[model samples]
Target: MSMYCNQCEQTAKGIACTTHGVCGKDPEVSALQDLLVHAVMGLSLYAVEGRKKGITDPEVDRFTVKAIFTTLTNVDFDPARFQNYINEAVAMRDKLKERVGVSFDHNSANFQPASDVAGLTEQGKQVSLDSDKETDADIQSMQQILLYGVKGVAAYADHAAILNQTDEKVYAFIQEAMAALTRNDLEANDWLGLILKCGEMNFRAMELLDAGNTGTYGHPTPTAVPLGHKKGKAIVVSGHDLKDLEELLKQTEGKGIYVYTHGEMLPTHGYPELKKYSHFYGHYGTAWQNQQKEFANFPGAILMTTNCIQKPQESYADNIFTTGLVGWPGVHHVDGHDYGPVIEKALAMPGFPSDEDNGTVNVGFARNAVIGVAPKVIEAVKGGAIKHFFLVGGCDGAKPGRNYYADLVEQAPKDTVILTLACGKFRFFDKDLGDIGGIPRLLDVGQCNDAYSAIQIALALANAFDCDVNELPLTLILSWYEQKAVAILLTLLHLGIKNIFIGPSLPAFITPNVLNVLVENYNLRPISTPEKDLEMILG
Candidate 1:
């Protein structure tokens, strides 16, 4: 119930209905989801033991990630599907136990009858909030931190899995953190240490994903993407998968179909290998929150490769396809790195007319390619060609005040360059801000996890100037929606990075006292109106 659920950001205050979740998930389903998480934790522990014994297997890593992702917000909205995940996790845990010479106690199995929905609901109601009575606020904070940290790890693991990258250490840390969350004796500092460790592990997860992507495809390079529609059929690749887009691009090459990136996928245009494709078009709409309206009249099929999948409207339901961890009840799912079904659907859809035209979108400027221009960038800074650097990025949410991001971007000074990443760029990504000194003022680094790139660029700039990163004229204006952003934010904080502007609203899960510590120490401020915030930042 919302009253009890500290897990969700959107939990209802005082009472999340004992019978159902605010997100439409019933209480029985929520319990099952918890059980699934518990099972995954057990499996992760088994895998950790396996690795300690030098018994490595890819299935262990795969199952660990798969279980955590299944628990993501709105990913497994259907209770029936979530039950399947639970069963799979239990089975995987058993398999791992057997492999590692450990025996799982079958006596702990808590299975409910499929036909007894009402009975299951009653049982869910009887479920105690705590099986162990260690509810101190400090302990609660630590548990919450680790739980949220694992959620963020699951997100990064999902992204890496899409690129076929799996790291045992990353997976092990997730399991270890989850297990720690289940422990009652761990002190506050222990939890804090684990929370920081979670951030450190997430850094590795992001690095693994980055390596997987750039290694499989190629380092991203600057390229102009087409924003307008072309003649014939087209498929819009949304979410955050370059591999899927690349596969679809290859499949649709010369087939009279155009492929455009949407949301986080917009950065794919920067990849040299992916950009080499002639059929790959430019980005379409803004962020994930705008998808419902943007896809209303889209004359092409849409493929979602990861998160930020909103409930599809009927207008575009027939044309929307999902892959990897992204799933919507009735929407078609193309799993296992497969884009075959997606490609076929795109070909079948009635594409845009040859005579119809929209516009063009320019993307690219990832770290490797950006670093290639480092000497020039250094020269520009020396000559006063570039003044302030604004890292305007993070996640997109359904909150109303998010428009502040667009306003802030619009109000950014002419001499400043904006380095953005993740879905947050949707705020001002579609705007034509023009370029300065042969480089676009707005540069998309990559996904949220690619905050690493933003850090790299900032550190590089600081190194060039022989000063600490905080001393550089770089400001981090971030908007967060989910746990992944939480991990990234912690990573920034852990590095002693300060002067951050965070909004559209603070996380509901963060207590006032915890937030105060962040604000007092890190100088993190909520975003205000663009005019005022711009004045404050520039001054």
Candidate 2:
């Protein structure tokens, strides 16, 4: 069966993945994701009716959020697992149907899947992105945009949920938005508006996730983390979830296993509670794209807790462990916070031969961390000590063009201050960009969810400079990979932030017309070369 998946920035040749997903999602897995989306749409139809009756199911809401998140690129490659989620979704929808006193409409919202994998594959074939024969390419693009943006929202919300943080508003929007897709009356413009609304809702989801993180782990503060620490029985934990890392830390507390962070997990070192752990040491690897090589070379077990998981290499497959929403067919999965096997594997492996001393990278400049130094930054800006502020961050990938981000920061003028977050910062985190007096020129503002922190810092700068945020001497040079970047880009556009530079490539989901609308309304531009983009932003 043919497939069509272009949900990530790194889609094959910058277009839909037809035969096989570039992210290692084979035809079967791609079909399952389509089926899962169809199932969610089915559940949303009933959930919508249930909401009208003031009888919403929190469990259904959670399921809808997670089901969509699991279908995202590079997540949940196991078709068998997706089949379970789909059948479970049908049950949840029926339960809601009983509560709303609404009879089944026999629409996709109530349709059951076939009993076998072949049947599920047949069902999925009809639901691929290309199968929707809406002649208007722009409307088709907008629909894809909304679905992708919501997937990002679900991922962030799922992270917060694991921390015991749930926003009913977010869950409600997830189902309501999915239900909107089943209706044919909505036009391209309608879907476009909904996409922006998803962006706004995503802002709230990210805010809740941020609140959950700070509430549990305490606010992030500026902390220096080692980049090369290969000592002892090392276990490198990657992805963005801090809760899983904390649990691993607790279980390995006195076990003598060295717990190091990798990729997005690098920001966890800045949290007060997490940083308190003596063995919660340093970072390993770079971004999500380098996992095959990085994980292969690591001395011990690798645990991935969230999105941005690559197909594990056989070299490290035996030691790779997946948890939460992350999955790769044969890899070990840890559930119920049981790190017993992971610990056992780490302990059994030979420890790092010696500490390489690869120097250090600084992170944890979240809202509280940066805002405390706001007055000083404001003074620096007013005194002509700081020339411009460039927020260069987002999801990092393995694209060869991604080196532009590191070069952009490296080549910035002497007086400019660079603010960065998320895994993208890994490109230049090791580069020494000098400092303004005691303040570092490159400020690490935690993870991608901490984008709200970037917004707060931007607003504060605007207030200090006495201008609209767009009027301030700030530029957003972003590089996006997946749906989370879509949500953040929409948030920036929603706030009227202008002249933002985004690259390595634009999303394949956006049609030429929809792309024009964004460009005309927001002046959002794709990034050029480091030399060229820097000139445009600085000028």
Candidate 3:
């Protein structure tokens, strides 16, 4: 196989993408990502030892997580960027090795990456996924599960750190997990335990991220976000970073430019700090999967703050820019938060010629908002006004069967409340699900990273009703596309929540044996049609 990646739901033919990634990642870029991951694995070796000696480097910790996040699906497709990360990883690894005064005969610990991208690609082919065929398939699956879960945790940890909220435990677990991937002694059961531990670490990382976002911007209040555009020069900020959006908003204030959110940034409008900007106007487009078409029609500049960026079309190639860990070849990369170039681009372009009132969608029903009205919610449930609650949200994708989410949401009984999050809500966000007892039937719980909020809301309800979360009349019908969703699933399993129905397709990395383990242990099932699944769930 020239390249092997099955980290997402839309892998080629529902199996491994053996040639090129379906996410527009070429073979060379894929190879470089593989090598970068191996290099990080090497750095993690020394990092684990350095911690044992009570010596830690903040640069190493930060770089380790950021580098892993760079390799996540749809984050960076630039081979040169991956090459730089690989070089930096090796340099930090050797620097730590010198400080610890330690040496090892293991190939991973002593490996050296080539100076050139061509040579590094060769090195990558050697250390690619499943390089060690001697390992059991189930064990390999568990190891990959742990690795991807760590990637999700790294993404959250990086976001949290950006907001000046961080915990060393998250970094330590990332390094330990990467270093553990080099070991040959762990059994399948042992790997399973580590996977659960990864889940626990993910929970902490997400908690830190929750605190960072809410603390930095204040808890999101119920806000109405416009779906239409206003007349002015405009910039649409995509991805999941609120700080980036805040910085752009600050720079563009009084510049006669209107800032609109796209994709996951839609939730940022609910933040008090970000929404305080008068020029922060409305939301444009749907999820990342539809960006190419939606962006082509947009008349202003585009700033991608994080992942979920696609190959830009020729029509708007000059209008799109990427920042942070998100990168595309030949696309202008903005460093830090200096958005001067973006502002200039937006001003240079012709924004909407006339205003369009496309109505609005309500966001900001996070844990705080939901729990703020716990009495009302609990009373509604007790009074038999609200029936079962369905938590139906996750990463949206371009693959078939994703329409199942919109179908499920539409067909959901009026008495049932749907608590949604992530970009997947775009399928039915505009639907007037109506309210019960002054409570909106649909509650947006924020981004995929905000799963902690959903968990807290569930726990609060469970506490109010005096029952386990699973015992409550709530069901999780989730759709996943990437590692973040994988991490959230692991967190749910770690919390001992049962009967999670995930679709449209399961992870390709999971072996049948490992799948059986999750199914048996957690009662996890692949989602059937919306009709069948809803019947089974609501019955």
Question: Best-fitting candidate, measured by lDDT?
Answer: 3
Which residue pairs in model 2 clash with each other?
Answer: 42-109
- Candidate 1 local lDDT, 1-539, one digit each (tens): 42144454444552233445544455666665666666666666677678789877677677667777766665555556665666676677777678889643322222332344444333443332333354775466556656766787878877787777877778778877865554557776687778778878877778777888888878877776666767778788877767777778877888878887777887778887887888876677777767889988778888887666777899888888888666767888886657777667777878876654566656667888788888988888889988888899988766568788888888888888888888887777778877788878888788786777777788888888899988988889988766778778777777778989988776655556666767898888888888888788778
Candidates in order have lDDT scores of 0.73, 0.86, 0.91
Please list the residue runs of candidate 2 whose C-alpha ends up more than 4 Å from where it truly belongs after superposition: 103-106
Tens digits of per-residue lDDT, candidate 3, 448-498, equal 989999999999999999999999999999999999999999999999999
Q: Write down the RMSD of candidate 1 (Cα, Å).
A: 3.4
Per-residue lDDT value at 182 in model 2 = 75
Local lDDT at 294 for model 1:
91
- What stretches of model 1 exceed 4 Å from their correct place? 1-31, 49-56, 98-134, 337-340
In terms of TM-score, which candidate is strongest?
Answer: 3
Q: lDDT for model 2, on a 0 to 1 scale?
A: 0.86
Clashes of each: 10, 1, 0
Error of 2 at 366 (Å): 1.1
User: Could you estimate the TM-score for every candidate?
Assistant: 0.88, 0.98, 0.99
Query: What lDDT would candidate 3 get against the real structure?
Result: 0.91
